[model samples]
Target: MNKTRILDVKYALTQILYFASFSALMGYASVYLLGQGVSNSLIGTTLALVSIIAVFTQPMAASAVDKKVIKLQSLVNIILIGTVILSLCLYFFELPTMMLLCVFVGIVTFMMTVQPLFNSMAFLFEKYGIQINYGLARGLGSAAYALASAVLGYLVEDFGTGVIPLFYIIGNILLIIVVYTYVVPKNQQHLVQHEQQNKEETEQKQLSFFQFCALYKKFMIFVVGVVLVFFTHTIINNFFIQVITPIGGTESQMGIAVFIAAIVELPAMAMFNIMRKKINCARLLKLSVVMFALKHLLTFLATNIFMIYVAQVLQIGAYAIFIPASVYYVNEVISKQDLVKGQSMVTVGITASGIIANFAGGILLDAVGVYHLLMIGVVVSVVGGLIVFGSIEKKKANVME
Candidate 1:
């Protein structure tokens, strides 16, 4: 193999392990919490707390990259090691069930938000003239998540719930090794470039909150639209198994559904990158929101496992179009200094909306069940579609000015 191909393969493998360690655990967490005898409300609250804290942590983590506090690979490796150790500690502590669950939740929450650090690293790689393809690396991770979730889901059916934690530990071990080895060493040239970029960004102009808000106007509206859509969809993301399993679907079936969803994401995301050159991303995003809105309404009416599976398949389009385009649009609209902060703001909005959705979703699930949650998703999704449509016109006006 050529040298470039080798690096790409290695980076992809590392990402696979990194996200496999994380996503597989997340795919089954709701089920795991249920097995541990936790209430839905408590689980939602735990997730909300974790995301709330992440609102603070992600920017700091990204800043560490800007400041050269640690090499990106080292930071990734340390976080993986920390995750594994903490997970093992929780497994062996023999504490009360609720306390043990809380500890596990906290650990996973912190580990999950290390996303921007990885993104910063990807950006750094591009800046350094490394032939790093972010989508392919990210795709491998998505694929790993599908494989792990499918396998573990079936295993849960046969071996029972006791094996879940063991799977988490095993995945993290693989993740740690990948992060520690194979990644390029930190180079001084890259650090100097990053520092220079940061300096120029700050020197240009300082933005007050109001100034930031003004600069953020159209993009912020788009992000807020995304947040509403995210809030709606999080209900499905978090509670899909709960919605389906009681309707004659088994754990294996749920796993298969999740596997299908993640697998569909691969090609969808891949095609999106290709399509970006041919289509205006904003138009694609508007169409995606429309499709997403339809999916939720379809989900609300779905009564069988087959229909739920179909709904999951439809979700791939929404994520593929909306997420990448939103980020690209935000980058186009914001100043260089605010790029990371701009992306982080989208994260904050999504997390904030998710907090509300998850808790309210739990209550909705209890009071009116999954159908009601699906109905709410349909409504919010339509709202998102409208915003996406409107943003195009608003964005044109801003550009014309």
Candidate 2:
């Protein structure tokens, strides 16, 4: 194969492994915690702690990459090594509550940072003239997530929740191999050249963090809208097992629900490039926000497990489009020098949403029940969608004026 084809294949394979590893670590975290005798409130607290760590660490990770304090490959290596070590530790050794909490925090910190860092690398590669079929690769990643969730569901059923750490170790090990063996050599030259170019461009005065925030006020608004939407999204995601259990769904069925949610994204993500040619990213994002509200409404109204399955189908309009669209929107709106920071800002929004969701979803699920919690999601999603719509409209009006 030619170099481009080879690079494309490697990138795609890397995405599959990357997201599969993520799925293995995070997809069933709540269920595994519950199985370990942790209460729902404690599980939520754990997740909130993870999010708090992410809030601080994600920006540091992005800044490190942006400033060349660590190369992308080096960062990936560090994360993979940490993940493997932690997974092995968790699997082979039983620890106290504090120790387990520390391990969980470490694992989440690495996983949360990986997505944005890898995404920034993809953007850098594209800027360097590498033809990455990002949508197709991302779709494959979603498929891998679905497959992993299904397999993990079965494994959890048969072997117990202890299987979680085993899968984490295996997935990260494979990811390490893929990075060292396949991805590194293919893209090293481009990355080096891109770094050199960035160095040359860095002679200009860099904006202070406060100044940067001031300058991107509009973009910040968009980020706030994203925060609101994901607030609801995270609640649904974290509490989904609870939602279906009342309707007689087992672990396997929960896996199927996750699979359904993930698989439906494939077509939408695969077609993202084609769709972007027709609809602009801003409008696409607005539409996604609307769909997100609809999805929450449907989920809130779901009476049985099948209804929840049907609701998962709406993942196409919600996350499938949102992912690619967010990437494009940020790339187009943010300058090259601030690209990593910009992506990190988006990650911050997501993590913040997750923090709120975990804390609130956990408490509410315990206090009022799943239906009431879902109704809260419905209300929040609608408000979020309207906020995005208004923001987009105002931006357009300002441009016209």
Candidate 3:
């Protein structure tokens, strides 16, 4: 294989491990916590608090990278080191069930904090003259998530949630090794991504998010849309065990549902670039946002486990297209220097939506019931989809070329 192809493989491996590790937290952490006797409301509170912290930490880390205070690799390494240490603690130490949840919260927070960096890693290789197959890599990453959730469903069923820590430990260890092993071609190693206008001026300017929002009004609109649309999906992902409960789904069935969702995402995400060739990204993004509502509506109306699985099949039109489209939309709207901030802002919006879902979804589940929650999700998802549909801009959307 050529050098770029080799880098592509390594990059894909890193994505595989990263998503596999994090899927444990998103897919099964609630199951594990509930197994440990953590109350539903308390589990939601844990996720809320962690997401609130991530809201601030992601921007700070992004600013540090912008100022060149730390390289992306080093920052990712630090987060991974902390994650491994925390996961080990969760595994070896028998703490109060609350403390175990706390440790798991730490791992989740670290994973959330580092995700934008992982996304940014693709652009990092552009400096080395190797354009990694990001869509293909991400598609495979989702496949890994599918496989992991499938196996973990049974493992947690047979062995216990102890396997959560094992997944984290093994996945991160492989990730750390793979992250550093990608080859940088000697010819492009020292190339600067862009020429500077004035080093002093750029260094003095702070990374102000509000400024970007003010200058780019549509971006703020986009952020709000993202928050709204993500609210139900984030809840579904985090509390999936609960999501399928109303339909009499088992952990194995939940795994199958999740596996179907992630597996279906592969082709849509991998083919995103080709899809862009045939259709404007704005149209695709709008369609995907609308599909988000449709997917939830199906889930809301599902009366059987099979119905729920059919709902999972909608992942192709929903998140699969939205993921790559959002990236393209942000790149189109935001300046190159502010791109990380733009991406971080998107993450913050999703996290903020997650914060709402975690805080409310739990208490709501405890107070009301799962189907009632689904009713609310159905209503809000439609509202969110409308907002997002309006938020997409057609002007300059064709600039992907």
Candidate 4:
């Protein structure tokens, strides 16, 4: 057993545990809360608050990691531990609506804000001279999410929503155990010093935030397209029950639908390496944006529960390709010095859209209905795809030309 194989397995385990925790909380919190007597409008509002808080806090946390205030793995462990404690808090105590919402928001926000850190950890062990297969690990993470969804649906059905926090506690604890077990036998103190020194050197040469914006205005436009395109994703994911309820889908079916959606992602990702042999990444990125619009169009036209599944199958072309393609896009276009923030801009675009969609989806559902919201999603996503298509037509220097 080679070191790479060992690290890959460890990372895959970590991803599985982390994503399963995500599924139990974020994926089904609406169902859980509704069972607890929370309203749909308030549910959406609560989720929006999670994204809102994350938008402000995640950067500060990331900056702390950047400045070496904390090590990445150590920070992740601390968060996982914090999540477990909060999950237990939710498990043991029954609270009033306001307090329950506040506590629930904290649990989800902690899990959600730490998402990028998990991705970055895929490359963390590279400093140890061994790189894990990130794509493989990420695909397995999807598998974990899919399994968790189906099982949680059953659990919510039979055991009631009370089991939600129990799952949260279990998942986070397992993740913590995994984190501590994956030890880098190399000199930890030496690596810490090396990392801090590199960060300090990078800090000295780092461009001002305004300059990064000015120099990469084209990428900023690209981020706009990301936020718009992701608005469609946010609606479908966060407001999934609303999408299906009018057509008579239940929690179990919603779980299955989510399962189908997530299960397909892994195979799509697995085939990406082969797909790259036939299609260049830039074209794939544009096609993915177009495919995102197509998915929204299908969702809009869906009148039956079966049609919803059909729309989910479209993830094969949309998100599955976009994830890897966007990473390549940043590397190809952005300077190395700005690469970290460049990736962050793309993530921030998604989070920003999440805030908008979450806040709006609840209101729209309360005011109009699901179909009206789906129609808006279809139109908005189509325009978003166009912006992405045009935004990446040339590199930054030639955009005006």
Q: Pick the candidate with the highest lDDT.
A: 4
Give the range where candidate 1 is weakest over 10 consecutive residues by summed lDDT: 392-401
Model 1 error, position 378 (Å): 2.0
User: For residue 71, what is the lDDT in candidate 2?
Assistant: 72
Better of 1 and 3 by lDDT: 3
Residue-by-residue lDDT tens digits, candidate 1, 1-401: 37657766767876787677665567777777777777777766666666777777776765675666776677777777777776776556666766776677667765765666666666665666667887878988888888887888889899876677778788778766755665464555466547756675775466665677787687777777888888877877787677786567777888888888889878777787688778777777887787688778777777788987897788677776777877766656666666666776777778888888877877777777666767777888888778767765323323311
| Whole-structure CA lDDT of model 2 | 0.79
What is the C-alpha lDDT profile of model 4 across 1-401, one tens digit per residue?
58678778989998898899899898887788887898778888999999999887776776677666887778888887888888898899988999989889988888977887877676566656677877778778889999999888888778888998999799899899988877664465357546856875786587777888898887888889888899989888887877888888878878888998899888778888798778877799998988889889988888888998898888889998999888777877887767777877897788889888888888887788889989988888988888887778434452211
Could you give me the TM-score of model 4 versus the true structure? 0.89
In candidate 1, which residue pairs get closer than 3 Å at backbone N, Cα or C atoms, i.e. clash?
Answer: none
Per-candidate local distance difference test: 0.73, 0.79, 0.81, 0.83
lDDT of 4 at 163: 92
- lDDT per residue as tens, model 2, 1-401: 38768878877888898888788677788877777677777777788888887777776876676666777778877888997898788888888867876887788778877777677667666766777888778878989999988888888899988888898788788878776754444446456646755764673356666777897887887778888889889987776678778777777878888999999988888788899889988899888998898888888887778887888898899998898888777777777667666777887788788998898888888889888888888888887777777665322322211
Model 2 regions lying over 4 Å from their true place: 1-7, 59-71, 120-132, 183-222, 276-282, 327-346, 394-401
Question: RMSD to native for every prediction?
Answer: 3.1, 3.9, 3.6, 3.1
Displacement of residue 380 (Cα, Å) in model 4 is: 1.1
**RMSD over all Cα atoms, model 4:** 3.1
Error of 2 at 154 (Å): 1.9
How many clashes in candidate 4?
0
Error at 218, model 4, angstroms: 3.4
